[model samples]
Target chain A: MKFSPLLDELIRELQVLPGIGPKSAQRMAFFLLERERPRGQRLAKVLDRAMSEIGHCQHCRTFTEQDLCEICANPKRAAVRQLCVVETPADLAALEQTHLYSGRYFVLMGHLSPLDGIGPAELGLDRLAQRLDEEQLEELILATNPTIEGEATAFYIANLARERGVKVTRIAHGVPVGGELELVDGTTLSHSLSGRRPLE
Target chain B: MKFSPLLDELIRELQVLPGIGPKSAQRMAFFLLERERPRGQRLAKVLDRAMSEIGHCQHCRTFTEQDLCEICANPKRAAVRQLCVVETPADLAALEQTHLYSGRYFVLMGHLSPLDGIGPAELGLDRLAQRLDEEQLEELILATNPTIEGEATAFYIANLARERGVKVTRIAHGVPVGGELELVDGTTLSHSLSGRRPLE
Candidate 1:
């Protein structure tokens, strides 16, 4: 209450983001104002630039500041033969961190959940199909999360990809590192046990 | 890794804010890109505009987009005989929230911590003295936090104000509402007990 209008505006704007409550927003507003005025300015500039300039890549639906994102622009990106499908840009970042996936990425941005009113069109399935038709992809890896919605979306996309004669794969999932037997839920432990394979 | 340049830029800018670690920065980055792009843009715009346009109010030392902030610009506020001194604009907000302080404010935006090389000049105590001379303040309330640095800063300013024949008073220190005695640490409990008064 009765905060500087600039602080008020910044806090209000910050509150619009996910998980940032009023108190945290106010703390952030004060901290930013105290430490670096330019930092706040730069954030605002980036936001303005991003909102005004960035758009979805024509091919992969990933956000881009230019006509195509750097991934799509790279000639050596293995875009022609291999592709990794993910639910959002965050997943893409996670995959990229491994430095193992040299293939191109297709970000769905959301999963298909009819209950949430998200469908094939909303998840960009038609765009993926178009990309599949245009590119000579040998394989399509469904690297979505292991959640129910992620599974349903992966299955739907895999079915569509299979119809077009492309190979489909799902990432393996089970108990995570440092997981405890007593604490692990039944379904997940069962899945871990069932999905076990020879170590050799 | 392998994030778009724009994404990388936004994340870098976000990291400049205090207490925002890399993980929270990443979450904020994705949240901005996905759910609140428009709001993010607006926030960014305000940040940019405020940063580029705002400066300290000549009279109070608080940030303002113009020569004086709205509070400092108001005739009613300037007409008040009491002056509240605070460590930062946030402290001013806390007092303003109570709607109990009808006086004007003078924000220090810092505290005197000589160990960290901060002193009277760094905290703009000289400027505050000048403001006190300019305005015929009936009372000057020291609203700094009750930390060691805050206490030192308060006494230093209080002494200075007394030398100039201006009345100076520090805000109270006491146990907060809903606070339990067992939960409170020793030093705080001592301060609260010493500062306690007889019931009216």
Candidate 2:
């Protein structure tokens, strides 16, 4: 049987999500159909509602219901003077998994890519710089990926923080060549942290 | 900050989806967090709603909001006198994309794999056999994949159909080795249709 156009549209939207290629999208679409009507309606409603309600945390740019994310609102986290900078909220989450950094985070959303036309302004570099100054951050940890674009973004942010006399650091090389921090095993991540050297 | 236990639960659930390994699941979880609170609620609602509303078509295992799926409900489809059997609803969708098959479909939802505890009973073979006896099936197309399990399933189904004194045919070898029907290019699929030969 042919999928209804609405069903196809939903599948297409799901396909846009990373790793959800055509087949997976079709499976998910069919799975949704197999779900109870209330379940599908609830999911669709929440999808629309979350898209409308979930906004960035003003303090750290992480997703949160309130102006500040849980980390930014917590007094316990405020005690830590470190700030980990990442290209996306997902990256911040990866670092958070380590339990090594009790500090705050700044999600840049994207890296510097001249070819793709992504630049400092587009990535909210000014907002990040302002936060660095306003928060009186002790350490600005650049945890962008190790790719060329990521490295470029890291250096740019590092320079911005360095100019303000705030110490800047990058997550270490425990991440393999062409490796993404999101995929690295926990032990390797810890070793990378322990072996971190100052960015020259 | 570590995700709350509830968020962790949701992320784990999301991870169970195919191709959504740990990192991608984490990304989806965080992305949803920024955007999921209500969206998640909606998803749950939709899941419950759709599951309750949809069920297996009485004639075919394809999901349908109504008692009979669109295909089974349509009189025109019943006139085709052919039956296309697939490993799953996704495979049925691949066949639908070809726009060549006018017959109805019977989704097995899985291939035969004795090693994996999958057998005729698990794949609803009895229902298919009943349908073959009931309908004036001109052709039973074994449109399953070319994988070991898929082949086994096809052979098993074909033998059953032949024993019932019904004609049986397998999809052409136009599908690449180890390639899923969903991944086959449209041109190759159409070519495969025209090149189909009688199965021994």
Candidate 3:
């Protein structure tokens, strides 16, 4: 029939993760059971510690062990008034890997999806508004993805910032770096053409 | 450049799982941290419970919460003296899903891979041999996979059973059910032709 009760429960719990379906959940459960028991124990410890200790950074809303994230807590980054707004901590981490941005970040943690009951409140727009009011932010960069939901989220945030006398800018939508024009989507190609910059 | 210490540790730990590479590990770690903390906490609890409570069935070497697995402990299945040997618990589960084999199972947990230091001791072949002696088995079915390691393991077990005066049989290797013959590999096609049965 089905797996044992404990194993069934493990598989069920594992499916709570994003992108893990029934098959993947079963594979993961078997993997945990078959491997050295210590590995599963270590995973448990890490999950417990992360759940208990990790929380939203007070300033930027990114995942952090303390009240403020490492980026927010750094004194050197405070003078950089520009704030980059992203949809998730993963996006923030991706941008951090580039080593280009010196300013702070505000993580929405999700994009706007009214159909799925995800709106301003769900995306923590109030907290974002508070951050805008408190900080001397010069230019607000909307670094959310270029999908429909991301566009809606960026537009909403742009309006919010512009109303408060802040300059809001969206990340350029165009053919990706090293991408061929023939391979790029029509919408992206159009955006790239319209937003093309003059070569200095 | 990298995730914070706790997050980094989580990514590394996730990578220990089978099929989980660096990218998947990072995705899982971020997913855990980003989701509701309770979900992660629940996964931790399940992992701990399964790891601590689940152990090998003394008789079959499959995962079980009790001393013997359900298949091994059931008195109804005791009369079925045919033992199907498999390389892993996953294989045993797959066979069980077929509902064709009422016989009991013996899980080697791994195949013979001398290059990887996996041998008889690692697969608990001594226990298998002891079971062969204790049980009045009619037939020993080698259900290990069709890979090189699986073939070697089957051959080794076949010799062990033949020496003990037990009937030994290997599962057929051919074109799978619902498979197109044109797409079937050459080796499989050859095996299918050689193993052709009479239409009685």
Q: Candidates ranked by DockQ, best first?
A: 3, 1, 2
By DockQ, is 2 or 3 better?
A: 3
lDDT of 1 by residue, B3-39 (tens): 6788778778787766677778888877777777777
DockQ, candidate 2, comes to 0.18
After superposition, candidate 3 runs with Cα above 4 Å error: B1-3
> What is candidate 2's CAPRI-style docking category based on DockQ?
incorrect
Question: What stretches of model 1 exceed 4 Å from their correct place?
Answer: A74-80, A134-136, B73-80
Model 1: how far is B144 from its true place, Å? 1.3
Better of 2 and 3 by lDDT: 3
Best by TM-score: 3
- Model 2 over residues A127-175: C-alpha lDDT tens digits? 8888877887789888998887998889888889989999988767688
The CA lDDT of each predicted structure is: 0.82, 0.74, 0.88
Best-to-worst TM-score order = 3, 1, 2
